[model samples]
Target: MKGLIFVELMNFMEEQFGELLTDEVVDAAAIPGDAAFTTIGQYPSAYASRLIGAAADRSNASAAELCRAFGRYLFCRFEVRFPTMIQRYPSARSLLMHVEAHIHEEVRIIYPDARPPTVTALEVDDALHVVYRSDRPFAHIAYGLVDQCIASYGEQSTVEWCEGNDDSHARFIIRSLHRSAA
Candidate 1:
């Protein structure tokens, strides 16, 4: 994982749970190197999982829920950080359709060591079928990101987790409610 992710996670925790709880969670997670992550630094993915687990243990929300929420928050942060990348697409559907070919490719170019998930979108009739595949177990995060992306685009859509072969593989079906009703 990249340090930017960890740094953003800390910011998300502080914003959502306050500084005290965030400090406690970080302390409990016991991440190496004082938990001071730089944007360009590389860290173990396990550290992120451990932090999420510790947060779940302290809070009422489950790890999956927290991951999803984090994803939502992360999307906003990404919008701020990479405005040009997002501005190229007029709608969330278009952005998602090119996530693998465009966005992730840009990420790889910027961060050669970063291992991002493969997000593939297929347009089927009135719905878009999105497939998420990754070595890390963060499909719930992807679900939340998709949810927020649609909402951010001012689109009325419903996203359903159609199936999951494993933690590494998940599929989501997104259909515009207005279009469907029409």
Candidate 2:
């Protein structure tokens, strides 16, 4: 995984849990490179899982839930750092459709070693259906990103998650409805 991810995770921990808890999580994680993360550096993904597990224990939340929340928070951070990426798409569905084709391609250009998840979208019964596949299990995080994307568009949306037969793959159905219409 990219060190930028760890850096952002640390930022999320501090902002959401507090400085003391964030420090505790990082210190307890026993991460390689002593948590001196550089945005361009790469680290083992297991270290990230450890940090998330520690944060989950401290917060009394499931690791999956925390990961998803972190994803949502990360989206806000991304918006701040890369406004053009989010601004170019008028809808969450549109953004999702281009995640693999556009966003991940840009990521590859910036950090050639980064292994972003594969995201594909299809339309079904007026809902945006997305399938997420990766060797690393971060479906909850993807869910959070989708949730925030809908919110960013000022749309009311419901995201349903379905675990794939393979542990590393997952599917999401996002249905957006107008706030007033609902």
Question: How accurate locally, in lDDT, is each candidate?
Answer: 0.90, 0.83
Q: C-alpha displacement of 74 in model 1, angstroms?
A: 0.5
Model 2 regions more than 4 Å off: 163-167, 179-182
* Residue pairs of candidate 1 with colliding backbone atoms: none
lDDT of 2 by residue, 42-93 (tens): 8888888899999998887899999889889888888887799779988788
lDDT per residue, candidate 1, 17-91, as tens digits? Answer: 998988889899998775889999988888989999999999999998999899899998899989999999999
Q: Which ten residues in a row have the lowest lDDT in candidate 2?
A: 161-170
Compute each candidate's TM-score over C-alphas.
0.96, 0.92
Taking all chains together, the TM-score of candidate 1 against the true structure is: 0.96
- Lowest summed lDDT across 10 adjacent residues in model 1 is found at 161-170
